[model samples]
Target chain A: MKAVLGTMGDEVKVFGFWASPFSRRVELALRFKGVPYEYIEEDILGNKSPLLLHYNPVHKKIPVFLHNGKPIAESLVILEYIDDTWKSNPILPHDPYDRAMARFWANFIDDKCFPAFMKAVMGPENEREKAVEEAGDCLKTLESALNGKRFFGGDAIGMVDIAANFIGFWVRIIQEIAGVELLSADKLPALFKWTDEFVSCSVVKESLPPQDKISAAFKARIDQAQTNTRP
Target chain B: MKAVLGTMGDEVKVFGFWASPFSRRVELALRFKGVPYEYIEEDILGNKSPLLLHYNPVHKKIPVFLHNGKPIAESLVILEYIDDTWKSNPILPHDPYDRAMARFWANFIDDKCFPAFMKAVMGPENEREKAVEEAGDCLKTLESALNGKRFFGGDAIGMVDIAANFIGFWVRIIQEIAGVELLSADKLPALFKWTDEFVSCSVVKESLPPQDKISAAFKARIDQAQTNTRP
Candidate 1:
């Protein structure tokens, strides 16, 4: 697999925080492309790294990709930059329509699914049922999109799959902490199978943080949220 | 200019509502590309067109671009598809980093600017001030991104410019109705000038709805929202 432009020694670095799904998305994309780089973990909740602040002044969030010392922030945009800059094992489909569809789904997962999932986990007690219902609907919609395909991009993992990394791994852990079953195998068989396959895929298998660590992080977040709301 | 892949006579259609900034973004992109498309206005609040519902079942929202009978929803995604499918007068910058920057700004406008603007208009009386402040911050961030560039892409209107269509025209009108001035020239001088130039650009000029109609529409919406919440 030849480098897209053979600027072989160009520095490629990723600024990320462990347990952040968005950060994992970028790391997964870089790994998929076989791009080597240093990964700097940021203290996102505490004092954020000054380099992260300098690189991503607008959002100041990770994962910011630093290529040849220039920064690119936002996980989805970083994924596109990775694909465009280093094209080995292309993650996006070639057809214009297919590419658009992939982007559309990725945007959907980001804009709709993530929020709904969070609401189910963190909404007030009275609204938790509605939030769970909405989250379930989002999963069902995603399952329909998969339609028994091997992956969201069909036959292999691609951009949409990476964008939806949470559904493939994080959701179940989140559900466990929230004491909900929104994405159970019985509820979304196709999606569950896809998740299994996605998590086992070579690069993704190594890229994801261990489940116990993620579970502990989530518990801490939920506890902190509850503590903040206590009057 | 030759068509990218000469699917001559391809049926390109746009399902949109006249007042929607998102819809206008897609229309402007098509016009810039010199691609002929039939625009179907959906009665979004009344009875949504079955076609829109069918095409964008998940979101059930407007700005669905149907190319050769396949529907692609999400305005930014549609813009990219239009650019990829019709290569004339390319709307996105060619460099991958530039493209990523364009997308980052576009995503910023969508994820940050639009929400803050909405909060300014429709938030509770107590929260309006905070909302306005946040919206102003978003504008200042956008102004910084422009940084005296003629357009977001430098020298020409491009994807980021198209994605920020709301800020270019809709924001001023929305400000008038909301009785707040978040995009004032004194505060956002660069953004104000960009908006003036953007709205007057040949393609964008024709794509936007008439000012009087949009003003009346927004007024009605704000009035109705207030009426609904009255004690």
Candidate 2:
């Protein structure tokens, strides 16, 4: 309920789309940091928020974290800001190598894995199998990366774990929306278990929007897209 | 030249491909840090380096910065490691927000710009235009992000600058090889200037491989791919 102001003491605000996974990542980071933030939901596909545009002139995309007056675009960047500014429970590890490891995996998820998932979601129907295969390869790599750690950072949740949380929650919903299972329990058991533990965390559990609502919103969007023939 | 060993202070070695942009990024970072590292050039596409495989069991790619014994993978991650361990001239800004900003742009370049460039490089003749357009969009965003800053970290070159240095040098060569003009002086004047300045920096200038060698290697790679597809 707290207003999220910019770091320079400009009024902090988050311009986010309700069902966006990227937006959710920022929200979770804020909640974990226990930082006060004002959330302004934008109808990204329909109406653009002036605040979003003003804050993120380049990408003009949500979720844009406006601290004081300076706007930090990019979910991963915003998350790091929250960790740095708040410094309550550090989201990134203290040791540089450990921190680098966390960042490496986080980057892996953002750069490699997310694209595979997106392809599975948006590729042509005939290419679904190929997309699924790509998604599987990405997931397999992720599974190996976990290394029997409770979270990607081991035991406690860290930046990499938070970044990869999309795999746990959104990936399932996306598979459902796209009608393909990418992370079956049989195939990615560690990742599946990690997802359960990740969402079960009090901070994450509290921050998550209702699943039914998200599912409904996604389905509606997909239907609209199918009807419109535009991406 | 000092040996660039892993974190544990084992025999320091780097398994790299002579012409790989990613490998060169690490090599430059190491040289900047004055880390003595043995450079073992690998035939990456045909024959894998045993050290590369042994060091980076997960990715099996370079530039793997092997400190005494521990192997660190990912060029960006290795750059950070080199910066952290050596602490010569810091590659990243001290301010976390600035660091995050640098990281965001770097990630943007790696995830968006590089992929677009690759598409332009490998696409069929008919798809070249679309690929170029995609690459242009990415370059424009990068230009806007620069906003008259000398380097991504304002005055000094940092991790983000190193990550994006490829745009200045390799991109032009790739453009030459692919016969596509994505980064013209008119379209991305700031970036063009930045690239010139970046490559001219004493450390970067000295570390860079010869342009003729790079161009030949890249052309050969493309030719090999084309030949492999011919029936």
Candidate 3:
């Protein structure tokens, strides 16, 4: 496998939590681009690493990519940076409209869908019903957006596909943890098929943390939430 | 006023809601780029215009930019399209890292900042405090993100700047309508200065909706919310 080099130097570092979908998105992007980077795992809920804080002082969030000494925060931003700095495999299309479409869906995932998904994952039983309804709306929109394309960008995994991958992979895991199914295959055949194809991609398959590990981590998180809420 | 023209013989049309910050962002981008497009206002809350539904079938949301009859949904996507399809004024940087940085802040505005701002605007009286606190945190991070740059894109009023312009303008109006001040100059000096500079820009100043109109609209919205809750 060819390693992608950073613009500043040979050393690249990523600060991320183990089970975060955002962190996974960046990891997949790096692996797809063949970028060689050292991963530093952080305890997101308990304590953040000093390096993580220093690197991303503004947001202080995980998935901070450090190329040489300069730090870039936000998974979507880092994906674009990785694609731009290393040109081995382009993650976005060359055409501006195509790029915009990719970004639009990516933003949609971050802005609208993720929130609804989170609500379903972490909410009271009564609120969970509403959350599921919202998630269903989001999934329907995503299903329609896929519209016969093998991938969101068609024939290739691009930025939007990377951004929306969480809905495919993590949503099921989250459902397993939450004990409810959010995405039904019958309702979203294309998205489900795309999910299968997406994980089968050599880069994605290799980079993904084990599903059992993810499920365990998610279960622990829910347990913690429940414990905290107990009177 | 010079009308901003798209490609030769292409009819440019914008499907937008009157008071949406997302729609306003697109309008600002078009006006700044000097692109001429026919504006079709959609009654999004009651009856979504047929053009809006036709143009954006996937999400079916407003601020859909139709250039030569091809529809592009999402404000940031439309902004990118306007910047790319027209070359009169560039909204993003030529350098990829800089462009990524601009996008980072733009995504910051869309994902983090705007949601908090909206929550503060529409949330209940008790929830407003927490929402305001979150909005303040976002603004503080944004202040640090600026880091002495004249605009979010260094010297240029780029895409990120356009994306964040609502925080400078509508936020203040909403704060007034809600009887709360979320952004104080003392708390976020740099952000406040940037807000002033942003609103004072020639195109921005010219294109902004009248303050009285916005205030009245907000008042009506508040009344509607109250009426919906009445027994």
Candidate 4:
């Protein structure tokens, strides 16, 4: 059961939804690390796929990473596992301090940025402004952390960049649907530029979903939300 | 620059708050790894120490780990860094799958169990029952994951065990203050027994806060919560 350079015997599979940023995290990790994985798009908004359900019984969320018949749930946790299993192109930094910092910021995005963004996009009309402000604060911290670097991981796209893929593409798409601009040149100049640079990277550009498709899906979701809330 | 065994050159320090389970995570990690560190308690409720703020400007939380004057924030991230830096007593399993599983559950405790437990304890009166039910569901997942194993890491205490430290001591104290039972023998027998075994482990026992003091602190917090909610 030894892992030879390119061959790890285990069949790699990813059960994911097209528009989910969590799914995109795993996709980018696999692609960046040069690991071969079959991607299965799950029907998340409708009937839950049995494979996803079986693989992820507890959370039952998309982006369930299955390596050699073993399923690993949670996007960040799965990303780390991918980095560990595939050592050819290391996703995390070698230095322990730098690695810890990368993980800290990634966890911040997962626990802070993503949630605040969702609240801003999906929250009630009366609360959207406050949520947008909170989300802006989260993004501001991220912008400051970049510290004039091109990527969160300086000079290259690394773990923190992969963790922040949502900011690069999904945030704008969400903003388009919600008709609220959270990431602007004036408020977040560095982050605004970071997003453009991040999404344009060859690896990221190849993996990104079709912009029109995602935009349409988000528009439908917003319409559904409005319909559910009508007086 | 090089970290020699038992003598990692740089001064190790842990900025923590008493009665904070997150703080205990770092203390237990340093103790278990046999790493020498100076513990500096922070006043989390009152004015936070300047050192804590300086080290961790983002969250401004306690248990900011300092190794050779460099700060690493977030307890889970710190735990991983400690394990990575210290090669002698490895905190995480070497097997990639096992390590991923450990990280997954540790994250579950942080992202799911603790939050649900807080909601159940601190949620408004009418929502208490639903919150309690949700918290119970979270505990049920933890119990099933344990599946008669002595510890989450099989025999020895590891990262998952450290993450679940709150369940061993703090949850009961919070339950005592809230007057609600979430981890009773009837409800979570495996977890109930697991907590007993977890707290008795020498490293965990030594690092745990004094029961009476933590209980008093919880009482004070509960009283403050009640006062804030009064019309």
Give each candidate's interface RMSD in Å.
Answer: 0.5, 2.1, 1.8, 0.6
Better candidate by DockQ, 1 or 3: 1
Indicate whether candidate 3 or candidate 4 has the larger TM-score: 4
For model 4, the DockQ equals: 0.92
Error of 1 at A75 (Å): 0.1
Comparison by TM-score, 1 against 4, better one: 1
Model 3 steric clash pairs: A4-A34, B4-B34, B4-B35, B4-B36, B5-B36
Q: What is every candidate's C-alpha DockQ against the true complex, given to 2 decimals? A: 0.94, 0.55, 0.64, 0.92
Across residues B1-231, which tens digit of lDDT does each residue of candidate 4 receive?
233743565589999988888989888888988889999988888899888999999899988999889999999999999998887667789988899999999999988898888777776656668988888899899999998899998888889988899998898778988898889889889999999999988888888888999889888877776566545
Write model 1 residue lDDT over B1-231, tens digit each, in one string.
337543467788999999999999888887877777899999999999888889999889998989878999999998888888888888888888899999999989988989888878876667778988999999999899998799987999999898888889888998898789888789888999999999889888878889999999989988877666555
Candidate models: Cα lDDT each: 0.87, 0.78, 0.81, 0.87
Candidate 4: RMSD to truth: 2.0
- Model 3 stretches astray by more than 4 angstroms: A1-8, A173-178, A184-187, A223-231, B1-6, B184-189, B223-231
Q: How close is candidate 3 to the true structure, as a TM-score?
A: 0.88
Can you write out model 2's per-residue Cα lDDT over A1-231, one digit (the tens) per residue?
122332334465788877787888888887777666889899888889777788777677898887767778998888877877777667888776787787778877877788777766765556656867988898998888888888886888888878887787877886798687888889899988889998899888887778889788777866664455443
lDDT of 3 by residue, A119-193 (tens): 777766557679888888888888888889899978988888889878768887778788777676787888788
Question: Arrange candidates by lDDT, highest first: which order?
Answer: 1, 4, 3, 2
